[model samples]
Target: MKRITLPLTDEQISTLKAGDSVLLSGTMITGRDAAHKRLFELIQNGEKLPVDIKDETIYYVGPAPAKPGYAVGPAGPTSSYRMDKYAPALLDMGLKGMVGKGRRSDEVIDAIVRNHAVYFCAIGGAAALIAKSIKKTEPICYEDLGTESVRRYYVEDFPCIVAIDCEGNNIYMSASDISAPI
Candidate 1:
C-alpha cells in the first residue's frame, strides 16, 4: 500500500497504477451530481466556477450530517459514472484526481490519460468506517443543495484503491479480464 497526500502533483500521479491500494491524507473537495451539473453549465457558458478545482481532487460523496462528536456521518462514495458527463471537461481544466466507487466511462478514462490524472475507488458498504478518516469538513458552495453541496474535507489515512491511473489502466476492466474464462 502507498501513502499519498492531497493535491497530488504530476510526479505523484504518474507514480500511481491501477489496482494499487493507497491511503490518502490531507484536503479534498466534495461534490455530487447536482453540483457537477452546475459546474458543467457554468463551464458551458464560460463562467467561472465558485470553487477552483485546479490540481485538486473531488470526491463524489454526499456526506451525511455530522453526528454529535464526528466530523461527518456515514460518508460513502457515490457512483462515479453519474458524473461522466462533466468529468472530461473538469479534467481538461487541471483537475488532477477523483475519488468515488465503481467503474468510470471510457471517455473519463481517456480524459484521465490526456490530463495525466488518477481515479480512486473508495470501499463500498463502508461508509461509517470511511467517516472516521475525515478530520474536518466545511461547506464550500451550493449549500441549498443540502448534502450534495460542494465542501472541503480534511482527512487522514483515507483508504482507497487506484481504479484508473494516469496511464489509462483501469482496474475494473482488468478485474473483468481476469475473471473471464479463456
Candidate 2:
C-alpha cells in the first residue's frame, strides 16, 4: 500500500484517483463535534487556531484511552458530515484533507473542488483494529477539550481510501451504487 503525509500538494492530489488504497502516516489531528464547533468560532474571528493547519489532515474521531505502552486507545472514525460547516473555511486555510464517515454537504464538496482537497475515510467503530496501526500519540494543544480535544497521532500504515478526489468525486457517498464493501 502507498503511504503519504498530509498537506497533499497539487502533484499528490492529481496523482490520486478513486480506488487508490493508501496508508496515511505522520501527524493526523483528531477532531469531532466539540472541537469542530470551537474551530468554526476560531475561523470566524480570524483567530489563530490551536494548531498550524498549513497542510494538515483532520481525523474525525474520539478514541478510547490507550492502554499502558499503547500510543492511543481504540481509534475509530466518526461521522464526518458533522464538521461540514467548518470544513470549507479550513480548506481556505490550506487544509487539504479530511477523514470521517458519511457524506458532507454539497457546499463542502464544492469547497473541496475549489480548494483542490480530498477526503479520506477510516472504518467506523473499528477502533481497536485501527489503533493497532498507531505508533504514537501526543497532545499538541486543546488539552481540556476531553477526548474531543485535538491530538497528534504518528501512525504507521493506517489503512484508508481516497473517498473524494480533487476532481470532486466521492466513493462512500455512492459506495452503495458502485462497489460493495470489501
Candidate 3:
C-alpha cells in the first residue's frame, strides 16, 4: 500500500493511480449533499464559503453522533454520485480530492480530469472500522444540519483505494470487466 499525507502536493496526487491502495493521513473535511448544496449556494450568491476547499480533500459522509469517549461515531462514505452536481463547482474552486463510494457522473469525472483531482472509494459497510482512524473530529459549519454538518477530522492511516485517477481512468469500470483474483 502507498502512504499519502493530506493537503497533498500536486506531485503526490499525480503519482497515484486508479485501484491503488492508500493509507491516508492528515486533516480531511467531511460533508454530504446538504453541506455541498449550502456551500455551492453560498458561492452562487457571491458570499464567502465557510471553508476553503483549495487543494483540500472532502469526504462524503454524514456520521452518527459521537458516543461518550469517542471522537466520532460510525463514519462511512455516502454515495458519491449524490454529490455529482455539486462536485464540479467545488472542483473548479480548487477542491482536489473526494472520498466516497459508487460511480460518479460523467460531469464529475470530467471535472476531476480538468482539475487534476482524484476520487477515492472507502470500503462501504465499515463505518465502525473507519471511525477508528479518526484521531479528532470537530464540527466546522452547518451545525444546524446535525449529522450532515461539515466537520474537520484529523485522521491517521485511513484506508481507501483510488477509484478514479486524475486522468479519468476508473477502477470501478474496469473491475466489472475482469474476474476477481482467486
**Candidate 3, residues 85-108: lDDT per residue as tens digits?**
899999999999899999998899
lDDT of 1 at 6: 92
- After superposition, candidate 3 runs with Cα above 4 Å error: 174-182
| TM-score per candidate, chains pooled | 0.95, 0.90, 0.94
For model 1, give the 10-residue run with minimal summed lDDT.
Answer: 173-182
Candidate 1 clash pair list: none
The backbone clash count of each candidate, in order, is 0, 2, 0
Best by TM-score: 1
Better model by TM-score, 1 or 3?
1
Q: Candidate 2 local accuracy as lDDT? A: 0.83
Q: Is candidate 1 or candidate 2 better by lDDT?
A: 1
Q: What is the lDDT of every predicted structure here?
A: 0.94, 0.83, 0.92
RMSD of each: 2.0, 3.4, 3.1
Candidate 2 residue runs with Cα over 4 Å from true position: 173-182
| Predicted structure 2: clash tally | 2
Candidate 3 local distance difference test against the native: 0.92
